[model samples]
Target: MIKVENLSYSFPQKDLYNSISFTLEEGEHCAFIGRNGSGKSTLIDIIMDPEKYIFEGKVEKESNCRIGYVSQFSQLDKIEETTVFQYIGEKFITLQNEIASICSEMETSSDIEPLLEKYQEALDAFAAINGDDFEKNINKNLNLANLNKCKDLRISELSGGEFKLIQVIKEMLNSPDLMIMDEPDVFLDFENLNSLKNLINSHKGTMLVITHNRYLLNHCFNKILHLENMELQEFEGSYIEYNFSLLQTKIEMQELAIADNEELERNEKLIEKLRDRATTDAEGARGKTLRVRVKIHERLEKRRIKAPFIDIKHPNFRFFIDNKIEETVALKVSDYSVSFDELLLENVNFEIKSNEKVAIIGPNGTGKTTLLREIFENNNPSIEINEAMEVAYLSQLQGETLKESNTIMEEFLEAGLKTYEDVTDYISDYGFEEDALNQKIGSLSGGEKNILQIAKVTASQGNFLLLDEPTSHLDTYSQIALEKALEEYKGAILMISHDFYTVVNCMDSVLIIEDKTIRKTNIKKFKKMIYASHFDKGYLETEQKKKLVETRIEKALKEADFITAKELSEELEELIKLL
Candidate 1:
């Protein structure tokens, strides 16, 4: 439906893409993936409106091919007062009303021909979108998403995730030939994320979604379009197949590189010796041999394997603490309740012991964020914390904790870094370049801002941390790095997250919100709940074993025990097959 040929784009600071080409064929669901700030969204913008950009590329689309876009940051600012049903059918209603108006005018107008023409045009437009059955389709979609109960609710009453899904429904009802959703799965709870997966699978038209959510990556897309190091790779397979292919290619490439290096070194030594002999004996035969060897060395250099995208550097995330809390409870909440227009939680009680890690998980609009904020504020009579613990918070809304107008360097300076050198040295570990120091935070990508939040929180030297949806915008590499960092953190953590992997791999337990109260559950039960709800019943068990074997393989490789690594690799393959 859409094709981009030899596309090259650049910003003032760096070139984003070079000669990248891809096609979105009809009925193909493609995942657009890359590291943060690698220009995934910008490329989408260029495809949607090529005239707005100054670049070298040819973007072609089928004539009259309609395109629907759901951007990363979308809000219902002006339409908050409308009911969900009305909002989804707003376009159809508008067209029907226009046609009725034209018919009423025809009853008294002298120019009946123009009125009739206008009436027919409106009817044709409405029919093009199957507007005659819009209400039925809307109800069906609502039921499929398990959101039929919310049909009469006002847009303002919906949570962030619900609002995002509603926007998706609105676009789908438009019946565009191609749909492009940029990070549409951000901030969605597990159930809602599953709803999105079902919607994508049932979609009949072409789709190009830019997302880094691992669950969706594993389950949704049939095609993968990976952008890395200013190049694009199009793979016609599932993400798992694509990943396995890359791993096999990496192993083969490394082996070839090793052999090539050995031969090159041997040729260098032989050339050195031949030159020395030619200088002593005035025969010049050694010189001819050396010339031939030099050509051979040049050929070897030309054929050397370049580093692949798998070797890209990931940010180093380290959460440190200046003082440890020895108290039994780092945080405690008893008989706590929170409400805005309605009561979301009542008589909720929970405690996090010193050095403990816990996750707050529930469906959307269940007051998880509100409860976390209340704990951070610590003004409620029911909430308490140890006096010896210092706390730091990472807000899901980056704007709450970061000043948009300030440059990266200035923000770090305000956070207590005394010198420019200190700011540069501190952010380097989080993957910020020297040139980024002068760039305004407002211009940075969503993932970059989140990384900045993490860096700031680490600098606070707090013994307790509150993180809300910390992995929402992060790429897979950074997310894995963060899991490692949180595993090693000495401080206590009370995190609010919808990411299943983050909770399973990092937290000791989960505080589930249900029936307007809090209940703590161990990680084992949480794992079973997730698997049963989203996958096969035994999938979690197999995945856990795979993780253990993978960890052992990493250790074996580091210790130069190739035999053990090979054995563990075989075990991991068996586990993957089960998954």
Candidate 2:
């Protein structure tokens, strides 16, 4: 129950929002989406505390409306020793303890009236949160999330994904009127992501989630708030429906654009003819007609169609290599094992041939990142690399590849970029603005940092790439671009990813880690396994059909076969409804 009207904000570098407005109605589940560094999080901050930001907007909330928030990056360092149950029930426990202390003081104090008042206030606060059912509620939520086993586990014992879910449950248990989660699905594994989907679906109050995960986008939201090009579009429909509408609009706009261009060409020719006639005429009538035609041409130019949102600026990702190793195994892992306090992976083995694109996939805390890092370091006895192969790594933790204190230009320069001009020209293809070159790497958004990592890795011109969660913080557009880039790459790739779409679209095969061992599976089986585990039955088949139809539509449009394109678009609309 909040509304923003006529909102506009800007930083010194550029404008962020231009008179954007949207409303979060009661019980509405809205997905907030946009490109990286588009100020989605900053807008959230403004909504959370309007007084903290100086902007032109009216942010109004219902009186006494309670709100809960989960930030993009949440760390449990301070509460690492607390149990999951204790963490979730901290507020209930505090009120309970306070009430108990006051009652005990009332039993032996001369000022019993004051003690009694304090005890009543504590009880009221506790009851307001349904404290009588606190334990039961906690157990129910944990079971609902399939996290009952983690109730007694210390925070330090949980995986990052599990801990994030716990934080979400903690906020939900507070029973706030509205919840705002910023990229809550960032690093979650497939199973945990499914649990998150269920949680969002079952939520009774309003929610505004910022996420780029395809699974979540396809399954979770009833409304979509797309922020692009400093403008906001609020669509009251499923994400699939919204996407279909945008596609239909794009097609219509293209048709109109063609007609408009044709009209402009005709007008220009007529204007030129009139000008030529004026040069040859003895009277001023031809000159007057030419001036009138020139004004009409200018008006037509002003009314020319601008590209739609489908043409939003996205990084043009390209991966290059210095040399190719033909028909040879680029990397091999033989009887590899790694452990930290406990055995995480044992007897793991995999190989990547030259020009092969493979993905290493598993649940959280399954040693995917560790294995990728070890492979990149090339110090393990069990790991082997071709002598001529050059390696480059993109770590999930950006700090591993990028220096925090260095500016974007300085970082590239340190990476052997010859000059500032060279760095600027190179990063431009990766979607970095020229002004961004002077900003510290640490100040960039998560998606921006990930893009920088990819740019740096590509610049190395390595024939063997070890990528750890390369798609983690990227926007959907960049993710698609990366899939295309990886498909076209003429090098070996061993990537660690939890993104099902990326793995399915880009990789030829998968090395799955389970039960402390590694096994290989083809892309078809991987697709089936993922659908069976995380999605509805037959969903994959339908998606495949939809993808095929979409490709046909694109081909028809390119060949100027509007009839076939229209038929395919209608077919695609039906297919989207099935999804």
Candidate 3:
């Protein structure tokens, strides 16, 4: 349905795409994946309207095709006062008016046979397009997004998640021939992300999604369009297959490049030796000159192979302990009842031991961040912290919190540093070279800002760390780097993040906030529970049986009862079948 040929674009610093070409057939669902600062978003914008950019590309859409787009950061803007009902109602204005007119005609007219036929046709059309059940589906989607309570609220009054939900719903309602979503996974939590995955999977129209969320790519898309080093490559398979093939291809390319470079060096060295021999030996000078010329020509004709591009850098993070902490319990929360106009959590209790790493997970807008802040600020009476513990909380990166006028060097110095020399090593750990230190903070990209936030939090050097979505805007490489650092951190860590991959990699235990209650589970058990929940409808029953059998088996083994242990193992096998 969409074809892009010889697409080339460039920014002031570098080329984003160069002579890249791709095509999307009718009903094709493809995912665009790349690291941060890649031109995924830019390419989507250009595809939406080629005239908007001064680029060398021909983007052709089938004539009369209506394209719908949901931007990553769409806002209500001047329509903030619009109500949810009114906002969605606007899409079906004509149909609603027609239905009302037909009903009015049937109510008052004496000769209603002609009107009856017209009304039946119009109603059928509405029903076919789901116009008749629009309100019901709206409520269903609102509940999925946890915005059912805000169905009557104005756009201005809605939370961030609700706004994103409205935008997604609006685009879905349009039912355009082609739908384009740029980084649609940004603000979604687990529940909402699942809803979006289902939506995209059920969509019949063509789709192009640019996202870094592996869960979405794995479930929603069937094709992969990878952008790397100003080139575009298409893979006709799942993200898992694409990732594996990409790594293998890169390794092969690197080997080929190394062999080519070695051969070129050898030829150049031989040519130099032959030239020297020609000058020293008068008898074979002509023969040596021809050999030298031939070798030099061969060297000139050889093509240089570029090495594979891999941008993985390690981040050096240090957490300093100011005082010795011998307390076994780093933090304890008991009888905690929290509410903000609604009961978010009630009568919940949990504890974090010294050097324990716990991940706080829940649906979006479920007060995970609020819980962390309450602990960090010590504002809740139900919470307690060890007196010897020093806490450092990493806030979410919002707008430009630093002064725009200051340079990166100046901002680091503002963190109570004596001089730039003191934090130079620290700054380098964030991938910032000395030249970038003089650049204005305002000029930094979203990914750069996220790295700076991590650096700032690390500078605090507290043993008890509270991180809220620390990997929010980081790229794949940076996210992995951050995860590795967190794994090695010798501090009491409690973090609220929606990145499930990072959570599984860095957290040893999980504190789940669900239905106004807190549930504790170790990493391995939690992973199995989630996997079963997705696959089985009888998850709770299977989980209970598995737990009971495991407990019995452990006791039997401890008591050296071989017969009982063997019986319990058989029971466990049967229970696994149920799961």
The model with the greatest lDDT is 2
lDDT of each: 0.88, 0.89, 0.76
lDDT of 3 by residue, 251-342 (tens): 44555666677777777777677766667664586666757677666755565554224333445555566654664899999999878878
- Could you give me the TM-score of model 1 versus the true structure? 0.94
Provide the lDDT at 185 for model 3: 74
TM-score of each: 0.94, 0.96, 0.76
List candidate 2 segments past 4 Å from native. 108-121, 279-284
Which clashing pairs does model 2 show?
Answer: none
lDDT of 1 by residue, 1-579 (tens): 898999999999878999999999999999998888889999999989899999997889999999988999977889999999999899999998898899889999998998888888999999989999999999988887778998999999888888888888889888999999999999999889998987888788899999989899988898999998889989998886677566545555655777899999999998888788778654577777878888999999999988647676778999889998664789889899888888989999888998899999999888998888878888889989898889899999999999999999999999999999999999999998898899999999999899999999999989999999999899888999999999999889999999988999989999998998989999999988888878987777787787788778667655656667666766776776676
Deviation in angstroms for 50 in model 3? 3.5
**Candidate number achieving the greatest TM-score relative to the actual structure:** 2
Select the stronger candidate by TM-score from 1 and 2: 2
Roughly what TM-score does model 3 have, to 2 decimal places? 0.76
Better of 2 and 3 by TM-score: 2
Compared with the true structure, the alpha-carbon lDDT of candidate 1 equals 0.88
lDDT of 3: 0.76
lDDT by residue (tens digit), candidate 2, 275-394: 788997726899889888889989889888875377789999999888877869898899999999899999887888988889988889988899888888899999999998899999
